[model samples]
Target: MQPVEGSDKAEILKNAAAHVAKAASSGSKIIVLPEYFNSPFGSQYLPEYAETLLPSPPKQDEAPTFYALSTIAAENKVYLIGGSIPEFNPQTKKHYNTSLIFDPEGNLLAAYRKAHLFDVDIPGRVTYYESEYLDSGNKLGLVDLPDYGKIAVAICYDIRFPELATIATRKGAFALIYPSAFPIATGSIHWRLLAQARALDNQLYVVLCGPARDTRGTLVAWGHSLVVDPMAQVVVEAEEKETIVEWELDPNEIEGTRKSIPVSAQRRFDIYPDVSAGTIQFEDPKLEEP
Candidate 1:
């Protein structure tokens, strides 16, 4: 959705509230929004928009965005994965692209600071460096949804790193969800491929939510919000319009795929070190590419 002219915090949040309510009315138990849902997908404005949540002040007046998400989750009784937010880190004096999850009770469940900062120089195409302004997360995140079981989560660029999904799969995550904003340059080609690769390799379901296409700004987004099944097929997708595409996932598919391939059980750990834990050693291991 395009932000209204001179978008204020309240208006940005009200727009989100409307979407959440609509999803709930359609019987969606779990709702996911696109990355940078409330703010424009630009780096310069991050500091101005970043805010804190729950456990702290962010000031006496709570961060309006946080309050809005929590209220919506509780009132609607829907599990909400609030897309990415620019977060201010006081202790480190840095900022991060952060994703937050809220339970139906309006309680904070999980937080994943985007680890793989988007930095690519596709000369003649598009160039962006999230590392220039955003601090990277040092760890991976996994959250368990009561009736639904475990689900792994990462932001846009983080999806390109297979290690994140591998670790989550080992920890029993049957599905993965990413809130993303794929710029037109890369999204046109790589968006769906990455989603399909992650799901196929892990034998799990993969869901992605992205902002609908809007040509007003200098930057353009490839808008094809989608979900992939364990079978590695695009189950449902949305056009450039602002709409919700919902689908049900079956765990049996995951079991069946893994059982047929058996790649998860047949890993040759003796030949290569396990990456499932995704631990970081004191010195980063460096190797030349194959």
Candidate 2:
């Protein structure tokens, strides 16, 4: 969906809620928004729009965004992948780009701070330095839903790193979702290529949600929200406009693709060591209803 640059937080919440509700009505199990859904992109607005991650229902003014997202997810009864937010990490005394996941019951399931900071300069084309204000996250973000298989959440620039997605796949992730916003300069060149490559390499579904192009903002988001199947097929995609995209994914397709290719099993472990050398821990995630 499109965002009016510097729009009121209340208005942004309203727009997001409306879009999410529409998507749920269409039988979408999981809904994702673009990075900086409630604020303008870039580091300039981090000081103004960043919010702290707190328990639900703080003093009226505390965390309207988090509460709004939880309430919307519960009311709609759908998994919510809240794009990215500039989060104030009290412990670090700095900000980070964060992604929050809420279950259908509105419980906060997982929070993933973006590890990859986008700091690049293209001379006359475009120059962005996310590292100037945003601190990078060290850990990865992977979660498992009751019905759906595991999922890995990666914010914008994280899409460029396949190692994160590879690690998630080793942990049995069936799909990967990236909430991203690429300026028109890079979007035209890398957006589709990256989406297709990730899906093809991981043999999993890839869902990329991008902000719509807004002329009012300097960061020209290449708005083309898309979904790619395990076979690297573009099943459904949205144009450069405000729209809700929904599609039914058949799990058999995943099984069929894996069985036919079997690249996952045929990996030359002797030549390429297993990435599963890392530690593993399972938490009985609190499933209490909200």
Candidate 3:
């Protein structure tokens, strides 16, 4: 979706619901939104737009976006991966960039705060620090969807870490979903590369959903939302505009890819330690019924 202007939170959500409805009408069982779907994507704006998303069904006044997402998912009867949002913890008085997942019944299944915050300083290029405003999420983002199996969820910068993807693969995730808002500088250079690398490394589907370009906004996002297959192939991609790209993923693809390469079966755990062997935190799929 396009970048939202100041005080347009309601409008942003309305458009998001419309998009989800359209996709669901076309037989999309699971839908994804971009990061910062209801607000602008910049560190400076985090505090201004952050909302409390706790206590299951958050008070409608305090967290309208949360309610809106639940309604959208339940009404459409589709699993919704709400893109990352600016979450404000009232008790701790800290902020987090978080993503919430809802089932077809509108139950809030999981919430994943971004584990890896984007903090980079390029001499003459891009310079930003998410740590300045937001706290890092410590837990892994894995949720099991009925019938379709499990999927790993992560924010933008988390995609750069292969261990998360690998762990998800070992834990039986068929796809890794990343809701991102990449600026033109680094995004133009590393967006697709990282997607392909993660998919190839784990032999799982990699899906990237990003906001469309907004020249009028403070930061211009590199809006090439794409899906990389298990073979590390870019099957479908969106340009730098507000559009939807939908494709059906086949489990056979994952099975066929692994059989052809057999890297997953041939991994030398004796030579190198398996990173996924250790204990990791995972979200319970039966969390917070509606």
Candidate 4:
């Protein structure tokens, strides 16, 4: 979708819901939106756009986006990885770039705040600081998808870190989903490379849902939402436009790829400690709705 002005939060959500509905009607079981789907994609809009999502079942008045997402998921009978939103933590008095997951029943499954902040300066091309307005999250974005295997969630900058994807794969995630809004500078170079690297490294699927490129907007997102298969192949991709990308993922593809390569059973953990090892708590898969 094109970037909206700061005051167009309501319009943004409306457009997002319409797109989601269209995808669901087209037989999409799992849907994902792009980053900043309910607001503009810049630090200047974070203050007015931020909304509280904690205390689960947040008041509709407080977080209209939250309710809207939940309603759509339930109405469509699909799992929804709503793209990142500006979150205002009332207790800490800090803001965060957070992604929310909803089950088919409209229950809030998990909320993953962006762990890595995008603070970079390219000198001539681009310079922006996310830490100045948003705080990083400490937890990993791992969640189970009912009968299907587990899937991971991460925001734009989080995709740059391989550790997060590795950890999620080690914990049994079949696919990794990232809601990204990459600028033209980095997106043109590292966007596709990073997604392919993560999928090839883990022998799993990598799904990237990026906002549509908006030349008129201050922050022009490099829209090219894509999906990489377990074989590190670009199966389906969209151009730089407001397009709905729908693809079916097969669990057998992941299993077959791993069997052919056999990397999971041949890890050299004795040489270097596994990054996913240690005392860690993963979400209980049995807790998923049957």
lDDT of 3 by residue, 204-273 (tens): 8999999988877777889999999999999999999888889898999999999999999999999999
lDDT against the true structure, per candidate, is 0.78, 0.80, 0.86, 0.84
Candidate 4 vs. truth: CA RMSD? 3.2
What is the lDDT, from 0 to 100, of the residue 115 in candidate 1? Answer: 84
Worst 10 residues of 4 by lDDT: 281-290
lDDT of 2 by residue, 60-165 (tens): 4656777788899999998898887877766666787878788999987877788899999987778988877888877777878776877888898899999888
lDDT of 1: 0.78
Candidate 4 C-alpha lDDT tens digits along 84-169: 88888776677988888889999888888788999999987899988887788777889988868789999988988998899999
Candidate 4, pairs of clashing residues: none
Task: Tell me the spans in candidate 4 whose CA falls farther than 4 Å from its real position.
Answer: 1-7, 281-290
How many clashes in each candidate? 0, 0, 0, 0
What TM-score, computed on C-alpha atoms, does each candidate reach? 0.90, 0.92, 0.95, 0.93
Ranking by lDDT: 3, 4, 2, 1
- Give the per-residue Cα lDDT of candidate 2 at 136: 86
For candidate 1, what is the total of clashing residue pairs?
0
Off by over 4 Å in 3: 1-7, 285-290
Q: List model 1 lDDT by residue over 1-290, tens digit each.
A: 22221236678788788878887988888888888777766777777788865344244364667768889999999988888788876666567787778889987777777889889999878999888888887756688889789887789988999988888888899989999988899998899999999998898999988887777644577778999999889999888777777887888889898888899889999899888744542111111010
